[model samples]
Target chain A: MPQIFRRSANSYARLSLLGALLLAGGLIGLIMAIGSSSYVTRANEFIEQPIQFSHLHHVGDDGIDCRYCHTSVESSPFAGIPPTKTCMNCHSQIWATAPFLEPVRSSFRDDRPLRWIRVHDLPDFVYFNHSIHVKKGMGCETCHGRIDEMPLVLQQNSLQMQWCLECHRAPEQFVRPRSEVFTMGYRPAVPQSVLGPQLVKEYGIQSLTSCSTCHR
Target chain B: MRPNQNSQFRNSQLPRGLGRWSFGRWECAAILLCVLAAGCRQDMHDAPRYDPLEASPFFRDGRSARSLVTNTVARGGLREDDHLYQGKVDGQLTDTFPMPVTAELLARGRERFNVFCAPCHGRTGQGNGMVVQRGFRAPPSYHEQRLRNAPAGYFFDVMTNGFGAMSDYAAQVPVADRWAISAYIRALQLSQRATVDDVPVDRRPELDQAPEVRLPPGRPETPPAPEAR
Candidate 1:
C-alpha cells in the first residue's frame, strides 16, 4: 500500500491512549477544584441583609450582649429576630435620623418587618435547635465564629454533615459550663481536657452518634 | 468505465469522514437517555407540601395557620393550675412560688432575664440599661422603695401584663419563667442594699480588704501625708 497514513496506525493508537489518560486526570482535578470552591462552602462570603448592621459596632465596641438581638436563643428552637420595636428602643433616640438607619426607621413606623436575609441557613433535613444546644452549654461562638469582630456577618463554618459529626462525636472538646454559654470570649477556667468531661456530666449530655439526632 | 458510472460508485459508498466525525447511533441514544433521566428525578426538592407558615391561596383568609374551632386545645395544652399559669389565687396575686426555687431555677432566670429584660432594665436591674441610655422611658430601679417592697407576684404580674410603657412579656416569657425572673429581680434588689452585717462571719474578713477606690479621670488626687500609706 502507498503511504496514505501520516504514521503507522499502532503509533497513532498509543498517542491517543496517552491523551485519554491525561484528559481523565485533568477532569478529576477539575471536579475536585470545583468541589472545594467557595461557591460550595460559602466561606468568607459577605451575605447582604436588609440593614447594614455592624456587629463590630454593636457587640464589640458598644458591648451589647448577643442576647439583646438574638432574643429567643435560650428559650426556643429558633433564635428570634428582634422586632422593629427592639431596634426603635435605641434608634428612636440615638442615630434617629441617620440615612443608613432609614430602613429600620421605616419598618418601625410602618409596623412591617425588615426581612433580613439569613446567613447560616441549614438545609430542612437537618434538625438544629438553638435552645437545646445553648442550654447544654455550647457557646454561640462555637458554631458561629467570632461574630463580634465581623463588620458584616458571614457564615464562617462549612456546616456540612461531616463538620457536624466532628463536634457530635467529641462534644466534650466543645462543651462549656452553662454560665459561660453566652460568654463570647469564653475559655475554660481549667484546661479543656480536665473541664470538658466534668461539664459533659454536669450538663447531662449524652454524646449521640445516632443518625436520627440530626436527620429526623 | 464511463465517468457517470465512476461517480455513482463513489456516491453509493459510505462517506469517507464518517469514522472520524460522528458518534454511532447507540452513543447518541445513550446521551439522550441520560439527559432525560436527569430531568425526571427532582422529587425530593419539589415535593408536594406547604412549608411552615406558607400562605395558602385556597383559603379565604390566605393563612396557613388555621384557628382552633371555637375553643379547641391540643393535647397537653390544658393549663389548669391557677398558681402556675395565672400567678394569682382567686383574683389577687399570690406571694408564693408555685414550685420550689432551686439554684437551677435561679440560673435559668438569670439567663432568661439577660436575654429579655436586661436590654431595658439593665443586668443589675438599675433601670440604666442600653435602651435607657439611648433614651427610652426609663423604668424605675428595682432597688427603689416602691419595687423593693412589692410582692413577688407583683413583679410577675407586671411581666405578665405590661405596666406603662413596657409591653407584656407573657408572649416572650413562659409563666414559670416569669416567676423565676421575679425571684432573680428580688435577689438583684437585695444585692445593691446588702449591708456588711448581712455577710456571714466567716466571709466577712474577705470584704474587709478595702477595695482600691480610683478617682474619676481629670480629677486631681489629694494625697494624704506620706506616712498614711
Candidate 2:
C-alpha cells in the first residue's frame, strides 16, 4: 500500500491535468475554425439555377452594365432579379431558335418566372441594403468579387457577422469614388490608403457597429 | 448520531450503484458544455418570415412575392402629367421637353443612355452596337436624316411603346431617364453632323487636340473567350 502511490505518479497526474487543459483549448479552436470555414459560411459555392446564366458572357464579354439586368440595385434593398421579359429582350432575336434558350422562351410565353437561385443570401436576421452600399461608394466587385470573370457566380465572401464587421468597423478601408462604384476590375487611381478615406469622408460613411445597424 | 457524524452516516447509507454513477466536477462541466454546443441551432438564421424572392409553399406559383393586381395603380401612380409620363400634349407627341434641359441633365442623359440604350444603339449612335454584332436586329443610326428630323417626343414614344423590331424599354428605363436619353440622342445627332463653326472660338482650339482616348465606364478591353469553370 505504501508504494501504491509512487513518486512517478506525481508527474503522471501533472501531465493528465495539462492534457485536459490542452484538449479543452483545442476543441474551442476547432469549433471556431469550422464556424468560419466555407463549409459553414457557404462561400465559394456555385449554386445550381434553373438556367445556367453566365455573368462572364454578359458582363465580361458583352460589357453590359450591372444595371442592365439588376435594374433596382440603386433604389432597392434587394437587388432586383430581372424578369423573364428582360432575358427575352435580347434572346428574342439573338438566339431566337436555339434549344438552350427554350426555358427563357417558355418562361416568357407561359408568364411564369424562371426560378433563379439567389447566390448571395444573407441570414434572415441580418438586414442588408444594396442601395445604401452602392450609394456609399462600395464597388459591386468588393463584395461580389470578380463576377465578370465567374461563368457561374459564387458567393465571394463569408456571410458571417465577423466578416461583415471587418468592413463595418473600418469602412474607409474599402470605399471607392461614387463614379467607380459600378466599375468592375476597379483599380484606385491613387493608392487605396489615400483614396479610401477620402471617399469615406466625402460619402459620410459611418462606422456603424451597433446591433441594430444590421440585426434590425 | 452527532452533527459531524450525520454526513458520514448518510454517505454510508447511499446505494453502491449510486456512488459509482456520481459525476466529478470536470465531468459535470463537460456535460454542460456539450448541451450548450448543441443549442447552436439555425432557428434564428432561418426565421419564419420570407426574404425577398424566397419560395413559398403556400402560394400556387411558389413565390412569396405577389404580382400587382391587373390595372392596380399604386398611390401617386396615376401619372396625370401627359407631357412627363406620355411624352405628349393634347394627345400629340410634341417636340418640347417636359423639364428644362440643363448641362446636368445632359450629363445624366449621357450616363443613362450608355447604360440602357447603348447596347442596341451604339455608344456613338452608329447603330452598330455589340448586340447588333451578335445578331440582334440593328436599330437605325441616330445620325440618319430621318432620325435627325424626328421629334424628341417621337424618340420618347419609341422607348415607351415598342418601335418596329425593338421592344419598349418602359420597364427598364424610367420616364425621366427616357427624356434624358432623348436629349442625349439629339446631342449625338448634332455631334455626327457638327461643323467647326458649331464650336465656340475659344473651345474650338481644344477640339484640334487629339480627343482623350479613354474608354467609357463598363466598356472593358477585348475580353478573353469564356473559359469553362
For every prediction, compared with the true complex, DockQ reads: 0.21, 0.57
Considering only N, C-alpha and C atoms within 3 Å, which residue pairs clash in candidate 2?
none
How does each model score on lDDT?
0.79, 0.88
Q: For model 2, how does the per-residue alpha-carbon lDDT over A4-51 read when each residue is reduced to its tens digit?
A: 468999999999999999999999999899888999888999998888
lDDT of 2 at A213: 94
TM-score of the A-chain for all models: 0.85, 0.98
Q: Is the docking of candidate 1 incorrect, acceptable, medium or high quality?
A: incorrect
- TM-scores for every predicted model: 0.73, 0.89
Please, what are the lDDT tens digits per residue for candidate 1 over residues B1-229?
5668656776667687763456889999999899779866755533455543345678875645465797788899897877777777787888888889898888878977887788779999988887677667899999999888887888898888888878777766778888999888988988999998899999988886889876532122653333322
lDDT of 2 at B95: 90
- The C-alpha stretches of model 2 lying farther than 4 A from their native spots are B1-21, B24-40, B212-229
Q: How large is the i-RMS for each model, in angstroms?
A: 8.7, 3.0
